[model samples]
Target: MDVPAGVLGRLRGICLGLPEAYEEVAWVGVRWRVRTRTFAHVLTVEGGRPAAFARAAGTEGPCTILTFRSEGPELDVLRRSGPPFFGPPWGPEVVGMVLGPNIDWNEVAELITESFCARAPMTLTRQVERPPG
Candidate 1:
């Protein structure tokens, strides 16, 4: 319960707000999916990042990693944002953001929404506001 429920709840709402969205626990945390395809994954590791990820990250675990779907230019922007956002292990098309009290829920929601849109089918994607360009 160290992490704020508000933060988690906000993320949950944004993800599940999408069409056919659902939640499942895995990788020691919860992941939101559209049908069977995961768009956002949240995990708080108590012992630094997992070994596999640490290699690429060059950092230990004990961090909250929230990975989401992102494409080239947009993905580049997130990775460049620094601190809270970074590249996840072995994923060219995804980004992982560190979660904490200082995190911006609005920005988080936008990222998760885009992630959902990217993974969800056209029929489902059409349901959301489509955010901004």
Candidate 2:
């Protein structure tokens, strides 16, 4: 699929200073990055098979949207606020399903960037975290 480059470019501008890679993931194109110590990716899954169209937020971190699919109300709000960020309109439930703690656009970008900055070299990192204590 011809994923939009504008979206990926926007993400690149948002998180500079990281090495980015564009590759075919899950049958779709994804942009991934690594910052010497961390990795991050971002993409969109369209059609039946969940394709990945990601933009790397950082090096050494899991990409955005891919990691924000399993959270809670925080994601619900994001789903409701779709468009420009999410692209197209989906019902509350559809939005919730696609955009969550590990799969939404905004949270995905933020999470990927943070994880890339914090992850240690060669250490397996947990992409998502529980609500702050």
Please give me the total number of clashing residue pairs in predicted model 1.
Answer: 5
Candidate 2 regions exceeding 4 Å error are: 18-27, 35-38, 51-109, 120-133
On the 0 to 100 scale, the lDDT of residue 26 in model 1 is: 70
Model 2 Cα lDDT, one tens digit per residue, 8-122: 6655554453334222343344444443322434455444223222212112213234332222454456445643233123223222113323334565456454444344233
What is the lDDT of every predicted structure here?
0.77, 0.38
Clashing pairs in 1: 48-60, 48-61, 48-62, 49-60, 49-61
Runs of candidate 1 exceeding 4 Å displacement: 1-4, 53-61
Task: Give the Å shift of residue 67 in candidate 1.
Answer: 0.4
What TM-score does structure 2 among the candidates reach?
0.38
Cα deviation of 130, candidate 1, in Å:
2.2
Give the lDDT of residue 30 in candidate 2. Answer: 49
Q: What does the lDDT read for residue 62 in candidate 1?
A: 62
Q: For model 2, where is the 10-residue window of minimal lDDT? A: 52-61
1-133 per-residue lDDT for model 1 (tens digits): 1334666687788887888999887765788998889999876655554665444444575666778999868988887777777776577888878776687788888888889988999998888887667
Would you estimate the TM-scores of all the predictions?
Answer: 0.85, 0.38
